[model samples]
Target: MRTIGADSPQGIPSSLNTVDIFMSHEGLLLEYEQSLTRHLPSPTDPKGERKWYNTGAHFLWIGDRTRQPDGAHVEYMRGIENPIGVKVGPTTKPEDLPELLNRIDPKKEIGKITLITRYGAGNVEKYLPAHIEAVKESGHVVVWVCDPMHGNAKVAPSGVRTRHFADIITELSKTLRIHKDNGRKLNGVHFELTGDRVTECIGGSMELSDEDLSTNYQTYCDPRLNYEQSLDVAFLIAKYYANEREDMERNVFRL
Candidate 1:
């Protein structure tokens, strides 16, 4: 639980050394920003060109609440060169996705748009398949990412906002399977996690209970995976992808 100064050379938490190692081994890093358009440099350029909002993050995502097609957030993000993502919740209509795609990635550019789905575990089986199909039918090429944390959040009996590690894993597994069935790839996962050993979320390798939350439940908004829990999740995700790779190899050999 050692705190690293914000001004530290790498700017990542000291406890996140494992994450650094994982990313180094994986050969790529993907970072997400919420409500990215709001923080963009104001349109003060004389030619009306936006001053690039360079937060050094790899990707930016509009929040679920602000993903309206005609909204300023979408309008502003449409012109940016960086890859953009839109949070799609269970309530999001599959029909509306085409217009969003037209607005954001009109050319059907591959990897330019990412639709991050946050459909809760209860609703994902019902909602996600259609959305993926609709996007595919439209002939759009966008990445699919899962935000399992937000969708599976719950309030524990202790009154703390928390997510079950089981729920997170379940939703992510479902997401991966559904995307594969639909002939699409679930490229990434979005999580709110910290490198600190705080007892926020329940039931990781540590088997944390509701009572454990009060010991160091230090989150301002939603609960996040603690250092160990984050590492556990990383390992689980790695295993999933590794198994997928092995399956692909076997299929290729059989072919």
Candidate 2:
């Protein structure tokens, strides 16, 4: 858990190498987003008029509950130039993917769309494969990312909302493996985390149990990973990719 110092060169903290950070949010508050929306001259059109962009954030995603094909959210998202994400949960129907893409990404624009899957650990094995196949069949270009936090949420006996680290890891690992086996790359991951030591979620390297949730619980909404827990997850993901690279190298050697 290294902290980036403000005095570091190029506006990057000393703890981290230079990196690009893009802002994102769930485009739920349409009014606020609409107010921030602005039109800028299109790069492809020197003579054409400006194009609409929700300058509020570089990227915005539609929640699973609001991605209706003819819904207002989809309509708003379709008209924006920013890349959009659609949350695909366990309830998502494989056959409906084409219709969803038809509404949001009619142009089949590369990198214009991302599908964030949030099937729980138990449901991921069953639902993700079919969803992957459906997207492949539709021939729609999309980046696939895993959102392990939302699906693995649970309420403790003490009536506190918490997510188990084990469940989160399980869901992420299964999602990645599923994508690899299906010949599609799992492009990225989304997580709710904080640098502060808040005991919002349980079960991390600290072995924080339900009893410890009362110590520093702070969130009014969804629980988030404390700094140590966030680092734990980052290390695990690094290990997964390292093993994957090792396997790829061995295969190439064999070839």
Candidate 3:
């Protein structure tokens, strides 16, 4: 749950690193602040400036890996409330993407790579592992966005509602632990959070409620938070691992 800070480089603290270094490409957010791109990159990279992910200590990754370029799509990924990568999936044939991947090669020439998979990008498990494993299965890292909010109202053929947000969370948490026990440092979590408090989404009440979860299909605006709400969750995540670091010593991860 790493936050895009106000003072840190690109508004992120140098010391804190999430499993995936997200690069949001939300040019439509300019509707709220016209000057954001003066500091951030546009969908077109209007300024053609270099990206900070190029040298960030953590692995470089992107999110919202969809092919849609509409305002709603971009806002979902690039909005301040949703500041993750906004690159489309392959087949759109965007030249800039491949170049970015090359620049952020996690292998560091060690023959291993850090590969990313988007939650809604589809068939993530197969395509992702195959890609990175092809590079170097021995040490490859695979990090997913694992949003706290997903699914919708309609029940799937599996007889379970799509709004089972906790299911994925629990699944990913177990995945992390397995990675930890197996001593895989390449696996990590990527969360999209802001500084705002959200009363809707997963849970209702002042906290969250089951009835509040998205139904049928999830719209782009299903989940959100206020500034204080976002910060509390972010700090909590940071502290949880910080405490684990104390108890587990070197085995616990903080980045």
Across residues 28-128, which tens digit of lDDT does each residue of candidate 1 receive? 22233223323454455566555445254456677888888998778767766667888899878999999999998898888888888998877788999
Best by lDDT: 2
lDDT of 3 by residue, 22-43 (tens): 4433333333433332333434
- How many residue pairs in model 1 have overlapping backbones? 0
Q: What stretches of model 3 exceed 4 Å from their correct place?
A: 1-23, 26-114, 117-172, 186-189, 210-222, 225-232, 250-255
Per-prediction TM-score: 0.77, 0.91, 0.39
The number of clashing residue pairs in model 2 is 0
Candidate 2, residue 134: how far the Cα is off, in Å? 0.7
What's every prediction's RMSD, in angstroms? 8.5, 3.9, 11.7
Model 2, residue pairs in steric clash: none
Each model's backbone clash number: 0, 0, 16
lDDT ranking from best to worst? 2, 1, 3
TM-score of 1: 0.77
The residue-by-residue lDDT of candidate 2 on 1-255, one tens digit each, is 235434555655554455777899999988998999999887788697799999989999999999888899999999999999999998899998899998888999988999999988899999999999999999897999999999999999899999999999999999989999999999999999999999989999999999999999999999999999999999999999999999999999999
Q: Answer with 1 or 3, whichever has the higher TM-score.
A: 1
- In candidate 1, what residue range of length 10 has the lowest lDDT sum? 21-30
Q: What C-alpha lDDT does candidate 3 achieve relative to the native structure?
A: 0.38
